[model samples]
Target: MGLFSKDIKTMDDLFVHQLRDVYYAERQILASLPKMIDKATSPTLKQGLESHRLETETHVKRLEQVFEMHGAEAKAIKCPAINGILEEADDIVGDVDDKQVLDAAIVAAAQAVEHYEIARYGTLIAWAKELGRADCAAVLEQTLREEKAADDKLSAVALGEINRKAA
Candidate 1:
């Protein structure tokens, strides 16, 4: 139960709930990255996925810290956005046969995931600060910044060459 529910009725409860949502989302991404990496035709894109996988592990650890800081057990609320994105990626991956087109699909799917993470982390950082946990905000900000960088890196690879090849 969250702050709005009968169980938890504080800003902290709401914050932790949101935190757990992203925590679960990140773990889901981590589990999915390997499949994306294996399917990626571009060396750079594969490396990017692998790197993001590592970063996600770090992100999970940071969330654990936030949980500890809040005196709550680390847990995850279901995140439909992530589930939907991953399911879409699976569908796209299945539909493509050409390596070039598949690479494009993977990149597009990855950007979707990164963008979702960026939005969640951005919101969590602001919420953490609003809840008077600047320390937690700082940790979250680190993950947020990385998510943006990863997105930018994917865009660069796509715009620089991958999308043109696919087209």
Candidate 2:
């Protein structure tokens, strides 16, 4: 459903729908990361991509458990924001000839994605707790923590060398 769609009947419904959105986004990230790894010129970027890919898989499994808890099918809603982000990253990376600059671009694109995820997961956790679904909140909390760590690592990569190269 589009943002601000009147079809959302309750806070619970909106929460679940957004959960599905990020669920889809995470799965897409899982698929796109390996390609990002391949495109990365820096060994550090490649390794980071690979590590996050594995983490993404675990994330998907956790989301599956959340779906079961919510008694909702673990199906994905189309998340255009994430799709656009991933597509843009691909387009930008494709156009770059400088490996260092490309790596920096990739890092920036990734941080954008991580920030989006952090926002979603943060809300999901709060909603879960507010709804008295502590189990769900805890489950989502794990993903939130990981998302934060990923963002921090990407920042370090950007500051350490990726930014240097891009300059």
Q: What value of lDDT does candidate 1 attain over all alpha carbons? A: 0.90
lDDT of the candidates, in the order given? 0.90, 0.90
Best by TM-score: 2
- For model 2, residues 16-129, the per-residue Cα lDDT tens digits are 898899999999999899878988888888888788889999999999999999888888999999999999988988998988888998898888889989999999999998
**Candidate 1 TM-score to native:** 0.94
**Which residue runs does candidate 1 get wrong by more than 4 Å?**
1-8
lDDT of 1 by residue, 12-90 (tens): 7778888888998999998999999999989988988899899999999999998998788999988888999999999
RMSD of 2: 1.2
* Local lDDT at 21 for model 1: 85
